[model samples]
Target: MFKNILLLLCMTALSTPAFAQDHAAQNADIAPDMPAKFTVNTDKFDFIRRDVMIPMRDGAKLHTVILIPKSAHNAPILLTRTPYNATLMTSKAESGTMRSVLQGYDNMPDVIADGGYIRVVQDVRGKYGSEGQYVMNRPLRGALNHTKVDHSTDTWDTIEWLVHNLPQSNEKVGIIGVSYDGYTSLTALINPHPALKVSVPMNPMVDGWMGDDWFHNGAFREEMLSYIYNQDATAKKTAIWWGNQYDNYDLFLNSISAGALGKERGMEQIGFFRQLLAHPAYDSWWQQQAMDHVLADLPLKVPTLLVHSLWDQEDNYGAIALYYALKQKQADQPNLWLAMGPWNHGGEIKEASTLGPIKLPSDTGLYFRKKILEPFLAHYLKDDAVALPQRVSAYRSGSDDWETREALPARDCTTDCTTLHLTAKYQLAMNGSAETSGSVSYLSDPAHPVPYVQRPVITRGAANSAWDNWLSTDQRNAASRPDVATFTSPVLTQPVSLDGQPLVHLTATTSGTDGDFVVKLIDVYPDEVPEQRELGGYQLMVSSDILRGRYRKSFEHPEAIPANQAQLYQFRLPIMNHTFLPGHRIMVQVQSSWFPLYDRNPQTYVSSIFTAPPEAYKPATITIDTAKSWLTVHTADVATP
Candidate 1:
């Protein structure tokens, strides 16, 4: 038996190598023939697409895609630098026509295709196909940023390359974008290149802490967490926001606190999240990055067209703020222009005939592109193009028409403004002051905060999310809440037009050491609308804002509120250009919390609200002095452009 076993083992081992050799020979014989490279034929296409790696001043290569019309020669270049993937922005469809591929965000297909302009879009450093490290709105080369290169230097390098490399293009270049890309367009203005003749920064992000994406006053905009996670977690934004719950209200409520929620979602791994955790106040880190402050000292050399949206949800504070900042310093410069439109953030690219239930007289988006943007660009970039005539073009909401002016607000708002007083009877009066004796009080529970919009509060950017037109939502939902204090003005017999920022002054007291106050300026429609039945009694929000009580003393240094004592809190809402028609009524609603949109204030003071314990959040009684609260709005006579 032993001899038989030894013979079997030897036979198996000898046959194994013979079988392996036979298999290897078979694999070599059947090897597939495939080409390593192939060429794409473009004779049938009307546009030429060139993808190149643009070298920056710091040696980092940014991915850029340029689209040139087949019949083009010496055509001016229109550029957009964005952190959002340039490949996605420039490639919308698989078609031979250039217009078909450029029909997405931040693009006007008709203007680009018909006007014969070469279109270019690039990925900023460290985003998408670009090579470098990523930083959220990287500060300029100074104390904050230890690096030698910034967005300004990168833009200068890019423009230098484009003019020299592109033989089918004119030397003139124009930069334009919305939001983050808009922010990049603004950066190009700092020590701009000779080729950069025009810039259009539409709804740019000027400041994160003051009123932009991250925070408003001192309250953290909690809804923007998903954006930070998705944008910063990976280079390709591969990290998905795993929000298991359908309603964001429940998702946020169940988490107890923003800090706790962030931890549970693994936000500790992101750099921006760590920075957000480190700085919860308006410190030097945030102040130095504000574009309004940074551009105040720089010269306004290029012809810049500042486009502001009346209902811009993400960046309502940016373009307007930067415009005013630059205007204060360079008021005499004719190159600086302003155009205020009736749309949401980046809404100029879409069909802007109406927003929600409110309808406009014309397609304002089309009018803007043909009449305002095209002319503005042509005059600067094209040699034979006619010059633009208007310096300021603003759209009036209630009138549903465009108005041109030499200056904004049409008049000096400080001297021509009207003050509306809030009386103890819950009436908005033009003459009588607020009641000196009594006050309005309500119970504010953190467990049951006021919703920013009607619930089933879906996550932002989700399918059918209310983020697009939440600014135009009916105020009745908030006014009906028990915690919200409502004050209404008598129906206007004649039209009253507001053309500037609305200043809010509230004298209030809270039972807790820390709290939040939300003030909303609404335009309440008449009880009946025969033409549009669904619009009847629609309480539209014209302008609104919020301020954390801790920052009442100072934005830099927060202090606890003296409980049960009347303290005056004053802040400015976003700018507005609306007319309260004869039958419309003006209403102001004040509340303690605007939830999930902004994180819930602990109501009790702690060193840092971001790290506040769950027990710190408690119910409190809030009181508003009726006689002391008043709203001041700038009025203008309605006129057509």
Candidate 2:
């Protein structure tokens, strides 16, 4: 009966006049009349924009964008090669002014406009508008990468083209960028082109395994999965990881292990994700890609400026590590310089007068651009430009001032390091020993790991997310946790300043076969603030780091930690030039897990934490021997302005 009714309806619809006309219209052939291309006239603009594809050593052609000022003649070329879209970076706003068009990442608009530089931005090979295969932080042409081409070769070819093709260029080029673009700038230093005069690598990704975007001291940064999925899954970054809920902490906590979450999210399709799972430990694969180690052996020809941020949430280790690595070989080479600012990742380009609740005396980003960056670039890329005086420009927090010195640590605190001992009574001491040789124990459950930030944790890159400045946030959230052990010092009688990396020496024991340890050094504010009332009693994190127990002895090798046995673990935290002002107290908190930010340790002995099963996650008792543990902080008597 249904088939008969359907046949009768179809026959009645076929007989209708409207249905017949619609069918005839669908069958009719319409001529295609769209234009093949469109043109953009920029004659009235202050700068002439050109889009071209520059060929690499291989057959790949990278998309390049060049912006020349209206009166540009013999101007220095400032190049920035990035995986990010060049078109977006160059054309940020639709305006007649050149500064309006180039106002995004890596382009200091005021400085660029004032310096009269021939600006150039390009898409790295295999990214947007570039033709080639994409590899995540592609290793140099070596054992890890069997291919003959790499970022260095591509940068060299790009510089060669820029010098020959542009008549307005002065034949001198300076490369500057932040993060991944900074990494590309470092690549150019390996075998620099003759035209390349200066290189500014600001917050670069030097080592992913040690302390960078990917991992920190053998702990996998699981939150970076979203970045890898979005970046490597597609050429134009169309693949975005959207969480079903608002809180990323709950989303990650419910997803079991990082490996399981990746599988559920279809991250198995990304080559970098597969590589990450395969190499859980620091092996040749990661060691070969470490730029600091790679550049240590190479000759330093270009005048390179290493820019670092005190509160950089990403790539914080790159600039500092590379600075030290290059300093080891800087006896005769005086071309290397270092600049440390009070900003977050890429915050040097933005208005850095304030970071989170902390306020600076001035716009530190603008100060750096005008005083340090502009002068350095002009001296190298232009003719008869005055040379910069200082080799190191470090911004000292707490005092809210900038210091120019000949070398870092300004003054060496190696032999005069201040040692803060942890006591059994939960106090930090400068001279006294432990009142009792007792130990502090806490339950570390994989099921209820401590959140890295406050509740309702949002994913990185999300709108209004605090991922960029979480390091500078208040640490009272973690200190209040029962699972975390806190040690506090009395209010400072005088100002105490730290000039170098703080060394963490811990003697700990875990009931489970394996575990992890996170140590944070924080600055506690006074109970009353006259200026910013909300900042009263604020606890700001100064320096912190984590160490995986399995790789405590060797980063390259992994072993099961002996259960219920005391073992010593030592590692250096990030460098800091902060001061504990008068009336401020210093606090240190120790915990087992920094979850969702880093993958849960499971607390059980597993060959690879990435592939650990649910059964491996067991609650374990962690003990800290207060008598044996102490934090070694380098103290410097910085001369305040």
Candidate 3:
């Protein structure tokens, strides 16, 4: 991995290459290189920290932390629906976690309360601090989003109770949250609660089954998600610092594997375990409460704001797909607005932003985006603050700048939605054909997984942890390694925008009975000096996946890999809303296992998604018909010069 990183540092993403840039100087700022800084006020909004039991429809009491302005006798309602403990308020947290940003500003109380408004934060049913047995990924059974009740029905009931019961005015409420909170906010729109108005699901993951958190193409994100619930589900009513490794730094930092904590704490909630073992295929269980299923009843709910990060690494793809769908449904209803930023699923620290351990200006600086969010609420519940213009704005990668459009990305979605056919190793480069032959392959060990930072789930408590599986080195870099396979294209003379789902189509026979087929779409720019810190320049990972070789043909059933058989292997990875700009090359990286990040697929197709030991794993030969096998991507024609 360091060797891969070393090569990356030398090549650089933006410039004077081969002669080499100073690696020591270049590597330091790789994380906070893109300098966008702001300020913050770390003082906590001393709202009446009252622990009230918000009665669910099932008559079960769920805990809520109401952080109303101490000064406000009458204020508007700013609600956050969370699955993590509602009591998990930060003593040092000022801006809000990435999850808080998704759910809506945690600073609503301070932002508007100074302006005079109340922030009502509620924990969802069956999770931390809330009463009832927790069901991981519970479908919205009834109107509420719960097993017996559901979020839609439960939320409506809560709003009804809070408005009448809690001390507030205007009877107006706005829902917000990220990940689970985003789901909860979406539920607020579905079947429309009359009192609920205005909402923002930041980097929200709408579909539990298909593209978000739990699984993608039947591949479960075993470590990040499970590790988190274990620590959190078993924790006491105290706020721990998120965004780093495990709960105990000494243990994780000392090179302890993730399993040690679960065993030490004896924290077997089994919520996640049941989720992993239960569904091997995309079943009705996952489909039941997906946003797509309930979109017909989606309410406009006062003005809704959709904030997603292009590099969100977690929920953006799923959320963006759902956002476009919702925009189409509510085309006539001028209530939806989309904002995409450069931050990860939660918030990636800015280069110059002030932040420290104890939390002061740094803590406050974290919430600046939350401050930007203040105006949205001020207008709706309080009927004040100037309104924002243009419903859509997205930050573009490579260019490292923000772009805004009046309408959705019609130019890309409509015009650039051309399908590229996948045959073997070489992909038709827009108007051209492949230069290289053979398939792109790599070794994906399930144990020593890579790292997924700068995206969401940089910490455990983040709402989306799906992409954590790709936490390792680049597949192209990995392909450069003997254990992997590489398929490269000559750097494009014309810029291409890979704006949608990138597909890998192949007809190959695998050796050693059965194995998985993994595909990664990568953007390789002209090597330059590592600007901020990513050495060897940065080759941003567009999307990736590992299709269980056994389930290569079907997700529902499993089959064996006949030795050296010419069976078809097709992998449709997560979507990529990216622009592979000019002077950059597009490469495909293929590898088998993503290590401990994702559970290992015992080269032989198996009934279980996990528990495949290392002995069961063996190097299998996957034939990529270079001349016949090809990869396809939804790319934009280079804008005619």
Candidate 4:
């Protein structure tokens, strides 16, 4: 029951903000008065919600809720597998909790009203109402030959039972969901059933360590600790606030270290939390847990629509990684496609037109639902002949235009892809003077780490929380911090466009053996914006990444940084398509820590950071050697519109 609440947390916050702008002319086809909520009144619709336990191949029964239209003969079945309990959709037992859970619950309510399909929502095995032992990202067992049971097998079994058992069902099944639910949809693609025609996995949690939900570049996400505690079967839901503390930045810091905080809250008893501490490095433990490794060899048989978001706070890289992997492996499977827009985690279901104070060109949420998602699924499920768009569909953040391609564009040449050297004077420039070889040093105190954003950092799982849009906030607060090294370039004379991943090559020396490097690529708006007056001098973070110093060589083999020695640390930031308009400046902010968001690295490298005592946390000085360090960016010349 608790799992259902956590699963729908972000989905609820995704729709809190209304589309405040008037884009009727821009989105002419989309209804101007489209309800702010992403749900339909169940009472107004003629459907019967039946709860039943579906038996799996392994004899494990799964709890499922079948919502069938009264006029359902010859209609197809639209199914969604979820860890979240399914009865919340139809039960009027607790109106208060039901209202809270379904605040922004998103589903094909329009399709339900149209009454052409029977909607099936079920709980995944071992979660909530389902019976079995729960395992996160249950590793795929290579192949299915009546050997072992995984999510894929469970999906196949469920679909097989539904097609044969349900009356008036045409035996056609389609799967769809978001976040954890999306993961289940993805699992259905591997060794799928014949009846599983289509699936859509939006911002799915594909991997634990590789920039999706849990860890980033092998660095543990401290902000998600509360979530880990919340999901523990034995533990109750965690309080949103940490004992009257307004700013999570301060609350997390006061706890000393992440492990210390977990211990204080008795989180170390949780199996998943304990496992995280056991395998700090990307060893076999994390390797098996990765979706890439699990589904690496399995060919995608079912046509899938991979959905991701531009500002997704959680699981940003998974769908993109999946899209790329599918492109190479399923080259002949032309049905594989990607659609990305300007939204946070699960924000695509909401008003995608605006993120925080920024406004997109149109209501991308409506456009995506009407033009892409609805049609793509309808074509396969209902045999509708409406054609889909190009394979790759992405929204350019600043440009405010959708760019579609048969395949992702390649990196530009040397002329267009420029390399800028970081200067000792805190300047980012194209030309470097060998004679002016210098380094800038700063004091990095674990006690007073750099805050990720100016606002008080809130836990992301809370409803209508500010955590979703923190990525879009200005970096003025962090740039002015003494621990952060700021490098600014001259105002751009011409518009510069970036179309690929931004690479950061750093040569730095740390006083201690273990630390972190957070590199941020920012777009500095002009000081005077006559039209949008408040947006003047806005420091919009375009791309950013973090790497643990110990993981410099390999994630599998973490070698501590040689103290006081300049070591080269190379890593790529998340890929993004954005433009630096004329009169704007490009800035880079490098820091040793991003507090609360990431665990504070105890400068001294120890055998186990989790067991390291509070004394291990100490102050250290980090130097950025400009002579040997540079930031390279992949850019494209202005193309004709």
Each candidate's lDDT (Cα)?
0.88, 0.89, 0.56, 0.77
Give a tens-digit lDDT track for model 2, residues 333-400.
57898898999999998888997787778999999998899889989988875778479899888888
For residues 93-152, what per-residue lDDT tens digits would candidate 3 score against the true structure? 445332232233333324544555566777776666777655544566654343567677
**TM-score of model 3 (CA atoms):** 0.72
The worst-scoring run of ten residues by lDDT in candidate 4 lies at 93-102
Clashes of 2: 0
Model 1 C-alpha lDDT per residue in residues 1-641, reported as the tens digit of each score:
99999999999999999999999999988857765777667788789999999998788999999999999898999999998999998778677788888987788887887889999999989999999998888889999998988999989999999999999898899999999999999999999999999999999999999999999998998899899989999988999787989989889877877888899999999889999999999999999999999998888889999999999878889988887887788777677998989899999877889977777778998888888999999998887857694888988888777889887762234776778777777777764644434688888999998888899888889997898888998888888888998889888888888878888889999999999999998899999988877888899998899999999989999999999998989998898989888989988899999989999998999988888888999999999998888888886767532
**TM-score computed on alpha carbons, candidate 2:** 0.94
- Clashes per prediction? 2, 0, 54, 0
Best-fitting candidate, scored by lDDT:
2
Tens digit per residue, CA lDDT, model 4, 9-82: 86677644543233544587666576677764457445656678999878899989886766778678888887
**Residue 147 of model 1, lDDT score:** 92
| TM-score for each model | 0.94, 0.94, 0.72, 0.86
